[model samples]
Target: MSSTTSRRTNPVDIIVALIGAAMFGLVLYLRSIEVSWYPVLLLVAAYLVFAYLFFRRQGGFGGVANPKDFYTGIVLLAVCGVFAAGMFDLPLGRVARPGVAFFPLMLLVLLFIFAVAILLSGLRNRGEALGPVPWRGLFIITGITVFFGATIKGLGFVPAIFVTGFVSCLASQKWTALSATTTAIVLTIFSWLIFIWGLGLPIALCGSWLRTALVALGVAGESIPFCY
Candidate 1:
């Protein structure tokens, strides 16, 4: 039975995988010489299609009504879609002097591979009981992430981080507002110190409006660089 299942050929999977492999090769070639945005975008798109087809063929969501498989598959697909969309128009650098998107694109490819493994494992263990899905927690965390991304530019790094962290913590039933606030504040400060001050990262501590207000109040220098 196992052999028969393994021997079963899904033409869609084969075609998609072939296309993905071709795209991967092209990406590698482009990386070796001159990197461009379009080719990389194409590669990512091909990979996404391949992933969808492959997972769908592998008894989609691990044989229907399996919440664990469904959740895992959905999360992986969502992440891949987000990454591809975010990186689509970004420039890709050369092999010697790679651009900002190079490493991230590579990492995203690895993430796709990892997601495939997860899907395969889920398929193999389809018989196992997948407990109830935590819809509240999932939605809460996702909302917090979206909120952070949307508000970060306007609120600046510190405030955005604190708000997101506190709200995300509240997703857990055990956390209270006070505890979440304290933890969020401490974590935000720690991250600021570590990533900004100690590491000399160019993260903005305050937005333009806040900075202007502080300067006007004589609380900050007029020439406040966005990075603290």
Candidate 2:
């Protein structure tokens, strides 16, 4: 493809890669500082990068000056500014709860704000500048996420993540053995941090279970006592 055609086909890929790298770095830094919700930030960056790349490759989100993009950007800007204002310097500590209602309330307001923004943009543009979202891969990915979240505790996080990654990648019809294995490893590490370390949740690794069994057998053998 010519440069222009390539640009038209995938203008957002570079942005997506950069965003992914930056977010990965951000989470690493945040974890080093013992910050809460680092995984949530990583999740947001993942979804954002995916959405941008997905839409651009499908058809550019109706071009650079697209109203939908502008509206989305505006709503995001408002969310940052308004939610911060609402959450900051509050006297909610004086109340019985001793904590601000800001976080939950901000989410509700932010959702409404985004809905309104999209509605207004659609109304103003009359769907002229916006294309239908490219959702072929998205639906499969969503299902994988749902399945992973629902089964992780019961199946073990590592196993659940491995299945999720393989299925998600395969759904894109772009999977090789190496890609599937790489995805599984990356997601397993992510699950270990987010569920095991960050949340203090017990999520056993399938490999670790085998290791435990071997250790138990070794200990049983060592009960001969003089070997200690």
Candidate 3:
């Protein structure tokens, strides 16, 4: 087929796009009015019905051929399940008081709606091929974050920040060890000054044991702020 033919606008695509835009506008309107969860739930049900019709018009479940769409749908569904589970015990406070659950629940509802839309779109547009996953980049980033979280408390703010930055930089093919190390040091110091000293956040700069040792040796005083 000619490129022009392949690129021709599909009515299904236009309809889905219009519906998505309308849904987004409705979300904004609902936000302004501070509507209750019950109404939002009703809207979600209505959207699902619309989504079902859209999917059916596109050729039903058998039409979905792209792996990307398959994975995206799975991820969105997983997220929806997690948020729904979390909402079970969450308190829906009054409009004036609006408990912690209020914002999360709203977000959850929006996510569910969007997820369904994405899944349906994927099913409709099954002509596209899936791209390769960047496993190396993904693993490196995930590992660096995990390491930072695991070691931050024991290693102190500066050290943890430095390590996180260095590792993250190394994840990219462009960064050399020396350049990454220098950048990491500069960033760690800069962040420490801003967030720890200036903002006076209550993060521990050093571990409890290290702080105790410093005090005993008279290198630092007990009254020194943990954050600094």
Candidate 4:
């Protein structure tokens, strides 16, 4: 706590923080500032949680003694619950025309199964120690998703997708800066075409953040859609 030498990577704490962040993000995605007063409170709460988790008195490998599968299953179950809770907001259209929740709900089904099995395996002592977690990979992937979900309203679809893509590429073992940039660019363009032009979704190409900056610069800010 007092010295760098006293600090160590605490993946469990990190992962729990990540999950909390992810849930906060999910709340944003579901509401997107539609609700008043509470989101700010939630943001402040999330900050407190991360601060406590990251800055609390430190130790080596701060996780449970259970096998990796156990905690992994537990986390997955938590994730499933988060998604399942939100599934009600999304329309569950018929099989011919699936709603936004359809795919995620289906995946949650599979995840529930896998989470249970892995958790059982962990209880059975069939897996290795929960140490040496792929914390970096998990952090990169989940962290980016959480960031995207939390910022999508402010960043909008294209920017959110691009940022998520770039950060996600960094998680890959064979990623280069050029490659990541190119991929993000291509992804942004394709998404803009699909979600903007093709689907005609209400998502803004340039979100409120850019719109506000453009407004400050006296650059066609009044014409911006979804900047409200």
User: In model 2, which runs have C-alpha deviations exceeding 4 angstroms?
Assistant: 1-127, 171-173, 185-201, 206-228
Stretch of 10 with least lDDT, candidate 4 = 1-10
Question: Model 1, residue 196: displacement in angstroms?
Answer: 0.9
User: For model 1, how does the per-residue alpha-carbon lDDT over 1-228 read when each residue is reduced to its tens digit?
Assistant: 233333333464455445655656666765367876666667676676767766677666535333454457568867977997898777767878878888888777656655554444445443335557788799999999999888777678888888888888988979987999899999898988898789987668866666767878998787776633
Q: What TM-scores do the predictions have?
A: 0.43, 0.34, 0.54, 0.45
Query: How accurate locally, in lDDT, is each candidate?
Result: 0.69, 0.53, 0.71, 0.64
lDDT score of model 3?
0.71
> Would you list the rank order by lDDT, best first?
3, 1, 4, 2
Q: Write the per-residue lDDT of candidate 2 for residues 10-48, one digit (tens) a residue.
A: 324344434544544443343223233335444564656
Model 3 C-alpha lDDT per residue in residues 94-194, reported as the tens digit of each score: 55667788778767766666666556555655445554777777888999899988877776787789888988887787889899989998998899899
Clashes of 1: 0
Better lDDT candidate (2, 4) = 4
lDDT of each residue in 46-145, candidate 4, tens digit only: 6545544443433322343345656877889899779778776777554456567656755655565556545433443333453466777899999998
Runs with alpha carbons beyond 4 Å of true place in candidate 3: 1-58, 66-70, 88-114, 127-130, 188-204, 209-228
TM value for model 1? 0.43
- Give each model's clash number: 0, 0, 0, 0
Q: Candidate 1: RMSD over Cα atoms?
A: 10.0
Pairs that collide, model 3:
none
Each model's Cα RMSD:
10.0, 16.4, 7.1, 17.3
